[model samples]
Target: MNVIPYNYSPEAIRLGILHIGVGNFHRAHQQFYINRLLEDSDQQHWGVCGVCLLPSDKNVVENLRSQNLEYTLTVCGRHGGDEVYQIGSLRELIWGVEQPEMVIQKIAEDTIKIITLTITEGGYNINKETNEFDFEDEKIKHDLHYKDQPITVFGFLAAGLRKRRAGNCSGITILSCDNLQHNGDTAKKAFISFIQAQDKDLAEWAEAHVTFPNSMVDRITPATTAENIAKLNELSGANDKAPVHCEDFCQWVIEDHFIGGRPALERVGVAFTADVTTYENMKLSLLNASHTLLSYPAFLKGYRKVDEAMRDDDICRYIRDFMDIDISPYVPPPAGIDLEKYKQTLLERFANRSISDQVSRLCADGISKFPVYIVPNLAKMIKDRKDLTRLAFLIAAYRHYLKYQLDEQGQAYDILEPAKSVEDEQLIESDSAADFLNLSAFKSLNLKTAETFVPVYLNFVNAIKDKGISETLKLLTA
Candidate 1:
């Protein structure tokens, strides 16, 4: 009945921060930074109380509970790798259904100074039409009226904020560590919209008291696999709840805008900057964009692992050309970053075969992923009348990719559309690919001017049908 792991301490209940979506990325990147802070200050004040947003998250919740919420991080690098078993940063793990009230109570607690979210990009529930809170969503409506039944991340955050505000918990910070552009601003906008729709007085109170810090987080902790578990047991001699294995590379750039207390994470390679927009855009456009490039077409070609995709000369070259030709020009490097060096490092990280990040996982939610990661670079290229040949092919590849086609290997696949709607589906299937480009989400791209996109897309579909992914990649490069 000893659920606790060897050498793992009992869960430390601290009133510092609430982290939603305690996935591998959060544990490896964010919690690792917190662990560094703990090392220096000996302060358990910043310890995290982890929360899962969905009921399906019981797998992670039960795993954590079984291990007494203990885990290890295997930091893999080119030269060598090491394990940090049970680093002891996280304090408590609470599932949404089991303890929704408990989550709100913690957020309401005066000692809980900050909240961090890594709830993935899709978790935000952003409306494509307005790029704001999807107020019309049935769940949002339910949460607005009934405080007891929480469904959306924004709903839980709003409820918690409402409670926090009622308790005069001002000076609290909300940090968003998702792969979103100006993520903190988006979080703030979501909260503000919710409050205004429900109660203007509360909106003003949040605006006056709350601070949302924009942040850029980079570390590839792919979904844990059985192989990963076996490796962790072999290497670390510890069985983790959700053991995180990542490339040695990790970076967190945050805007210095916390209202409550924040850790001095800068001591551990986290950059606190005046403007994090450039850093965010650089990562999203370069790394995330390159990821999509490999994820879609490569996955279609029967590549499951990230390194497998990267190993394909054709796929790796396409990804490289995407960064070199399209993304880099638009990426204005933030202070203290070298763009060339960063790009080289990203490629190396992508080529790391040990992690085995799934292309299907990356390919999921492309409807949301591309607009932020790839489309922006293409838009900039279109405006300047630049060589969108590669960019066009990327879009074309995506169009062909969405049809849920299988490879010669008989592997099943499906693309995650922004919304499961006929109109949304038409974004990829339309005869006029340009018209589809006018989808509410991508209208900002001003695709009407890009005369070459439709024809290029049409040709791309033809190439895939006639020539296949490998051959089409060659043609695009040529």
Candidate 2:
């Protein structure tokens, strides 16, 4: 297949956007949009300068740099087709760990007007219970003490914004594409808190100039496996590294609150609105929460791929009921959105055979995900006195998955929860469901003292323990 590459010359494009955590999602979603915008118009200056903060990102950074920061993006469709595009929007790649000063300088540069982020939900270092930046985090502490040589994202932001202020560069918008609720506001709070602690003057400057616009970004971008790479190479006949693939469906709803001018993203499928809360809530609750609800149970049952799990009748019904019965009630319909269609579309997206989203990817960072995606809906269901059987079973599955490292097939896998603490370990290991319910993580919701919910949840936990996942799920649904 002769793939048409980016039409614009690399020399003419200017780095207008600086993105942190340049992983698979950023490439497939945000960069995909920018690539379209560039192809359609003369807005060549809106090119992205990608930044990788962690040391582990060296491989990707090197790969992109060696390839002149150009890579292929294969968008897979549900039925079986795919559209391949050469993404040239990524004009530059910077490894922050290798050259922290360069990262700061790029941020301070006047041409850079917007900074976007897809740092995972836990990267903010917020204490879920308190909903505040955790200054006590060891990385935060190090960043606080050694501001010149920073490590965490917060440190980089604080230092970078300080440089921007000193240089008298125009204000920039920090748009967060993470899946958290009110992600833009969360980013503001986390960044402002860090800056305020480091330098009151810089924080005040940021308050006056910096803008964090909340955005709801949706796209199912699976981790690029070795098999995917080999297949992509064979199809394209190109020895490209760091290529990315995602589902063809993509949506980006952003608040139009940029300090400086923004790319005419609206020209190319981006929705710029005054308020994104409703959209954010709907997506997070229905799609994200449903993912969490299905992940642990599917993984524990030895299902590795989301589509495979969706094919299972029992698992499919459980997720459908969980979304319609448990989550849909809490999510208000965003403007111009049909809730019924959206729910059905979510199911279709989950069942997209071409994407092959991994259960392990969904199960990763359960500690952070549970608080953001599951807790709020769980609390609402308890308060409303609705059916808690499915919700309870999901929690039970999470606990079981956490406690036991082995899946149903007796295969050992490491649970990738970095936020698990000593207390969390105790709660996961505890035999009593009531003990897990009383955890400080869920203390804010006070589900522990619920008159009916507690007992129902406990019973579900016991049933799962006594009668295995399959039978318990059948009994719950029946």
Candidate 3:
């Protein structure tokens, strides 16, 4: 297989976008698009400066720096051969954990027109109930006192914006390229709230200058395993340390309210819309929510690979019914979208063996995920007095997975719940089936008060424990 390297000069490209999280999703999606855009001489200044905020980012950052920030991206399709590309859009790198001052300075630089983020859903430090910044956070408190030497992303944003104010630099856009629904607005609420608590003047400056545009991004990017790296190096014939692989499909719909201008992204298949509400709701409710719906039960049933999970007739049927019967009514089709076809395409994408998205990736961070992906639609369903057996079963399975730490086959597995607090552990571990409903993920729905929802949920919870997950799912799907 021939590896198609970027056509343009890498050194000539300068940084215009300071992307906060240099993760696989960013590499596979946004950076891939920018790499394409950089092929044109006029877009040379639009290259990305990847910022690493966490200590976990050290290895990837070191690898990219070794290669002068150039890496490979393998695009796997549902039914076609892989297209290998040596992407060069990531022109610079900065690890904020090591150099917090530099992170602030770069954001203050007028040359950097936009600050894009791939910080996962829970990274916002939002109080789930209030949907605002959690000021009581110790790190946030530290940032408030020591604004100049910042640590958190919000701290970096505030300090940087303040520096920009002092330097009289033009305002920049803060676009969230994450999976969170209404992500831009959420970001605005968090940043503004934090900045307001720390400095009134800086908060006002950001309020006037900053624009957070809502965006809907799609791509099935799996975590690159050691086997993937070995195979990628074999196929591309490159000793690339920071190589990334994702499904061929990618979509980024922006609210088109960019400050200090934006790249000609539309020319590169990016959609610019006055409103991203419909797209956000549709994608969140259908793809993201369905991913959550299937993850626990599928994992509990001992399926790790999404493709393998989808191969099961009952699993596929469950997901299909979820999209059509549970979610379709609320998700109005965005322009040019055939809802039914999109749902079919999603199934096909999930079933793509080449990509093989991990069921565990879907299973990770369910504490944060449930609130974002599942609860909204679940709340609506409860309000409408609709059939919620599937949703209830998902909760039951999640409880079983978390509390037991064992699959239906009695195989012990590690669960990844990044947002799991001590209190969350207590609730999940509580013997009472009804106590799990009070988990922060479902707090907004107030499931205890949900007359139609609780009885069914508790039934599944009790039945799954008594009869086992396999038998219970067989009954649910029947």
Candidate 4:
């Protein structure tokens, strides 16, 4: 028997954007939008030059190269329905850790107008206290010492911008697709702090010339599994080397701020607006908050899959109540979005049985994720004097998961725990449930707000212990 892999010829397009942290979401949302521009218009100069931040990304790089940097995306559904989309928008691929100079050189090029990042929430090594670059972080220190090596993303950006300035290249957009509040602003602050710490004049020049666009991106993309690989081959009839499978929903809303150049993304399903805060708040507060709620409880209940837990009536009802009660009031919807309808659509999407998004996947990086996704709503609910029973339950779930204990049945599982530093990458796991809340982490929280949360959080801990996980679920849901 003979087998042939699909071949996609690279178009003669100049790289106008360099995307760092090119993960599944980047492929599904950003690259998908670029693909639309490629097919509809003649301006092919905006093709993406992909940059993988981590050394482990070599697997994806090799797979992409095998298929000439092209892959398929399937927006799968609960039933037997699915939508297939494909595009060759990644014209070039560069592994940052392997070829650090290439990343800097490409970014310094006059043709590259944008440098987008999907480096995840925790990837940016910022000091939580100062909200600035963590100079003490080994990676940051190494990057600063070996400034020529361009080891870290911030280092690469700073070095490239300095080069562009020396050469008088046009200013480029720095877009962040991470789930941080005011993500673009955070990226800008990090860049500014790092640059200023090193050189004052360059920092001022970057401040005056560059553009940082904040965006809200949504899609439920689980880690690639054997099943996912098999599904890609079965559904698409091509052995996709780096296939990205997701639920049948996707959304990208951006502030229409760009420097030098941009793709006609509006031709696709992207929304470009003046104020993306409302959209950002809605997605983070409701969608992400609810996800944080379900993640731990589902894992504690021994349901590994997101779609499976969504099928549980107990879980589904709690999810709905979480959105309508705890999360909805805090989230001001973007223009033209019906909050209720949107919630309904999200519930449907979450319940899509075919997509096996994992609970552990959602639970990762809670130290960073909760601060943005859950903390704001928690703070707002306290301000409004709303009942925190639902929010408290989420905290309780975190506490229970931190125990990292199997149920009475002796099944084993894992939950993410924070470390003392980035170098101490191991999770600080323990059987003590209270250790999970880490009240010290919330000490900087407003005095009045923090005091109120203490009692409710304590009450939740009692409920989780006095009653079992299922009973706590019933109490919260009822």
lDDT of each: 0.76, 0.87, 0.91, 0.78
lDDT of 2 by residue, 1-478 (tens): 5565777777888889999999999999999999888865568889999999998898999889898889999888888777788999998888988999999889889999999999999888788788888898888889888987888888888889889988888999999999989999999999999989888999999999999999999999999998999887777777889878899899999999999999999998999999999999998898998999899888978899999999988999998888888888788898789999999999999999888999999999888888888888888777788888887788778777887777767788888888788898898888777778756557677777888677777777777677777788888777
Mark the 10 consecutive residues where model 2 has the least summed lDDT: 437-446
- Per-residue alpha-carbon lDDT of candidate 4 for residues 1-478, written as tens digits (9 for 90 to 100): 1222223335556678899988888887888778767665455787899998687898998889888888888767757577667758898899987788888888899999988999888666766555667788777877677767767888888888888999999988999998888889888888888888777888999988899988889888888887788877787787777788888788999899997868888877889988789999988887887888888888877788888999888999999988887777777787788999999988887888777788889888666777778777676777787887777777776756655466524587655655334322222253444344453233244423456666777677777777767888877777
User: Where does model 1 exceed 4 Å of error?
Assistant: 1-13, 408-410, 416-418, 426-441, 446-449
The pairs that clash in candidate 3 are none
- Give one digit per residue, the lDDT tens place, for model 1 in 168-248: 766789899999998988888887787688667778888888999899999988878887788776777665657777878
Give candidate 1's TM-score: 0.93
Name the lDDT of candidate 2: 0.87
List all candidate RMSDs to the true structure: 3.0, 1.3, 1.0, 3.2
- Winner of 1 and 4 under lDDT: 4
TM-score of each: 0.93, 0.97, 0.99, 0.92
Better of 2 and 4 by TM-score: 2
Residue 205 lDDT (model 2): 98
Which 10 successive residues of model 1 have the least lDDT summed?
Answer: 1-10
Backbone Cα, N, C clashes tallied per candidate: 0, 0, 0, 0
Query: What lDDT score is found at residue 128 in candidate 4?
Result: 56
Residue 286's lDDT within candidate 3 is 92
lDDT string, candidate 3, 1-478, tens digits? 8889889987799899999999999999999899999988998999898899899999999999999988999899799798899898888899998888889899999999999999999999998877767888899999999988788898899989999999999989999988898999998998899999999988888888999999999999999988889988898898999889999889999999988999999889999999999999999999999899889988988899999999988888888989999999999999899999999999999999888889999999999999999999898999899999899999988998899998888789998998888888999989887888999888888898889988898999889889987788778888
TM-score, candidate 2, is 0.97
Distance from true location, Cα of 460 in model 2, Å: 1.9
